[model samples]
Target: MTKRPPALVAIVIYKTFSALLLVVMAIALGLTVKKHQLLVDFSESYALEGKLQIIKWTLKEILNLNPKTLQFTSMAVGLYAIVTAIEGIGLWYQKAWAKILVLVLVGISIPPEIFELIRRMSLLKLAVFLVNLAVFWYLLRHSLSTRDDNQLQ
Candidate 1:
């Protein structure tokens, strides 16, 4: 059997990381739902502010069983993660659809990356932005080159 190329390997790793992050987020959400007081105590202890307040407010709604916003958000996150994982698996198998899916995802992420750079101008954030740009460029170039190869064959 032929070994996968480096680009494919990179996508597999990215997908695995996304899947793991989703699982961790899901578990944390569950814990927050089950033990609201735990979250409350932690927040109170830390004297959290700003974005922390926003997260706390969101969690409060979830804890109170206000299903609309929380349910929608959870569903969206779950679907996105699952779709991304599927695309990753497909890319590992060198499927054309996966290449398109990845490009689309990368496109969608650009705005948020820009927003992050504007919000926090730090070396760490710049490094992250540059890394993402590199990943996006590498994947795009690989996908296009592969497509060209197929056309010439």
Candidate 2:
């Protein structure tokens, strides 16, 4: 097998990390269904009562969600996690489909990211958008370079 590029390796690592976080989020959301008090206790334990606005907001939103909604969200998050893991694995193996998949997904997400940034400028959102943009650019460049190399051979 040919050696993988450093940028591809970095992207794979990012995907893996994202997948792991999504899996944890899915499990947490699933467990919290119909457990509003437990979530409150968790927030208290973490001293998130009024410390972080984002954390408080997130907990409030989650608490407001019905059990059924939470279940559905959990399933969706889990599915996304699975997809992300697959992307990372495929990229690690240098699969063309994975490159295309990441490119398309990242490309699709850029618009919403821009809208979100426009609605509310936040450091985290900006960082995420920038990182995703970089990932897309690098993957596109890599794909083009590989195609050109193939044509030359």
Q: Residue 135 of model 1: what lDDT?
A: 66
Q: Spell out the clash pairs found in candidate 1.
A: none
Top lDDT model: 2
Q: State TM-scores per candidate.
A: 0.71, 0.85
* Shift of residue 111 alpha carbon in model 2, Å: 0.6
Cα lDDT tens digits for candidate 2, 1-153: 788889889999999999999999999988888676788787668577458798888888887788798899999999999999999999999999999999999999999999999999999999999999999999999899999999999
- Candidate 1's C-alpha runs over 4 A off are 41-68, 122-128
lDDT tens readout by residue for model 1, 1-153: 568888678768877787778766666565555566676676566455555667778756666764354445566677777887897788788787887887788778878988988987889778756766776787799878877998999
Q: List where candidate 2 sits over 4 angstroms from the true fold.
A: 34-58
